[model samples]
Target: MLGMSTTTGHGHGHTHDGINWAERLGHLQAIDALDRDTHADVAQRLAAGLPEGATVVDIGSGAGGMSSAFGRALAAAGGGTVVLVDAVPALLDAATAHVRAEAPAVEVVSVLADAADPALPELVPAGDLVWASGVVHHLPDQQRGVNTLARMVRPGGRLALREGGLATQCLPWDVGIGTPGLQGRLLAARESWFERMRADMPDVVRLPGGWGRALAAAGLGDVTSLGFLVDHPAPASAPARESVVNWLTFMADMAGEWLSEEDRATVARLIDPHDSAFVGNSDDVFVLSASTVHHGTRPVPPA
Candidate 1:
C-alpha cells in the first residue's frame, strides 16, 4: 500500500494528522528509482498513441519521477507539455527540475493544487492525456475525483489511472524468525488499517465496482485495464533491497497498532541492520509487485 501523507506546506512535512510527508517523499523517491524501468515502460505505453505535441497532465504528481519518465516518452514522441499538479509546492518544484533535466525538450509546467479541489479543472489545462497514479483512492469522494479528472481530458483523449494491484511481496512466507507467514499477517492488518484510514478521512464516501467501471460511470468510453509486473529475482540489487526494506518498514509503521506484538518485534528485527535477521543482509531478498492502470478515453462527438 502506498503511504498516505498530506503535503500542506513548505518545509513542514507533517499534516495536522501527523503523517510525515518528508519521510513519505523519501520512500516514494526510492520506489521510483527502483522501479524506473517499469515506470518507463508504462509511460511509453501511455504515450504511444498520443498526438504530436500533446498536453499531458499528471495529477497528484509526487517527486515527479513518473512525470520525468513521461517527459522522456513525450520527448521520444516529438516533444510535448507535461503539467505536474500536486498539493505540495516542494514536490512540484522537484518534479519540474526533474522533468526539465531528464526531458529538456519537453515543456514542464507545475500547478500547485490539491487533487480533491473542485477548482482543479479550472486551475489546470485540459490534457490530451491525464494521468493519476495512486491518487483517486485518497479522495473522500472517489467518483467525484474521477469525474474531475475526466473533465480535464480533451475529447478523444484518454485518462489513465494507476490504481489497484497485488501488494508488493518481498520476503518468503516463512522468514525463519518470529512466526511463519509474517507477511501474510501483516497484509491482513494492513487491510484493517486501510479501512480505518478511509473512515478517518473527512467526508468519506463508499463506491462500489472496480476502477474500469468507475471510469465508465464517469462517462468515459472504451475503458480498459492493464497490469505491469515489477520483479527483481534472487540476489536483488542494493536499491531493490533498500526499497523492499523501506516498503516493509512503512507498512509496519502504518499498521503497527493493528499488528500483534510478536509481529511488530519480528518487523523491527527484520528491518534492523544490526540484527542478523535484517532483510538487507540477506542475499535472497527480492522485490516483486504488480501495478494496474485503468485507461478510459473521451468519446469523439459524432459528425
Candidate 2:
C-alpha cells in the first residue's frame, strides 16, 4: 500500500528502493488509458458479489489505487466503507486523495499499518470483506498475512484478492520494471523473499488458489480465481511521456545493486521508448492471475 519501494520488512537499502510519486501517478495514468475499462470492468464483477452495504478491508492498498475502485463500487451499491491499509504513509496520502477525487460518495478510511501485524485483527474486525491488490509481492511473509486477512473477514464476508504474479515470464520487450522484470529485482534483492514465497505462495496461483488455500486454512469457503495478460504500451506521443521514467524507477531501484549503471540505463531507455510492447511476441508469457474470490462464515456464533 505504500509506494512500490516500500517493502514490508526485507529492506534492500538500495538507493533505487523508495517511493517515486511520479511513476506511481504514471501507472494510474496508464490505467486510465486502458483499452478496456480495467477498474470498472473488474469492479462491476466484484461489486455484484457483495451485499448492498458492507465494510471492507483493503490490504496493501498502495496509495489506494485499487481501493479507490473498490470504494467507488461500494458507493454505487447503496454505500459502504472501504478501509484502505498500507504501511507506506505517502501511498496512503495519495490513495486518500484519489478516493476523494474519484469516489467522494464512498466512505474511505486510510490506515497506516502492516498486513502481517497482529494489531491488524483488532483494526479490522471479523466479517468485513477484505479486498487486496498489488500488495502481495512486497510482503515478506505471505502465509501470516493471508491467515490474518482470512480471519478479519466476518461471517458470510467475501474476500477478493489480486496481486502481481508471474504466470509466464515476459519476452525481452516486456521484461522490464513495469513488467515481469519488476519481480526479478525484488527476487535479486530479497533472495529470501522469493524463496520463502515459492515454498508457500501457491504454485503461482495469482489470485484465488493460493489465496483460497489460505482462506480455507483460516476457515473460508466458496473460492474462485480468474486471470489474463494485457500489455499497456505507452504511446510515444502520449502527453505524459516523461512519466515512463518515473514508471520504471522502482524496477531500476531493485536492480540498482545488481545491474551495472549502463544496463540499468538501458532499462530506462527501453521503458522510455513509450511504444515498447510489454506483451512480447511469444507464447511463453502471460500476465497470468488466479484472482481468488472467496466467502467465509465465522465458525463460531456471535459471542
Models 1 onward score TM values of: 0.93, 0.65
Model 1 spans with C-alpha error above 4 angstroms: 1-18
Q: Report model 2's TM-score to 2 decimal places.
A: 0.65
For residues 180-223, what per-residue lDDT tens digits would candidate 2 score against the true structure?
A: 35535533544543444445543333334455576567666666
Best by TM-score: 1
The Cα local distance difference test for each model comes to: 0.84, 0.54
Question: Which ranges in model 2 have alpha carbons more than 4 Å from their true place?
Answer: 1-36, 125-127, 164-209, 233-247, 260-262, 271-303
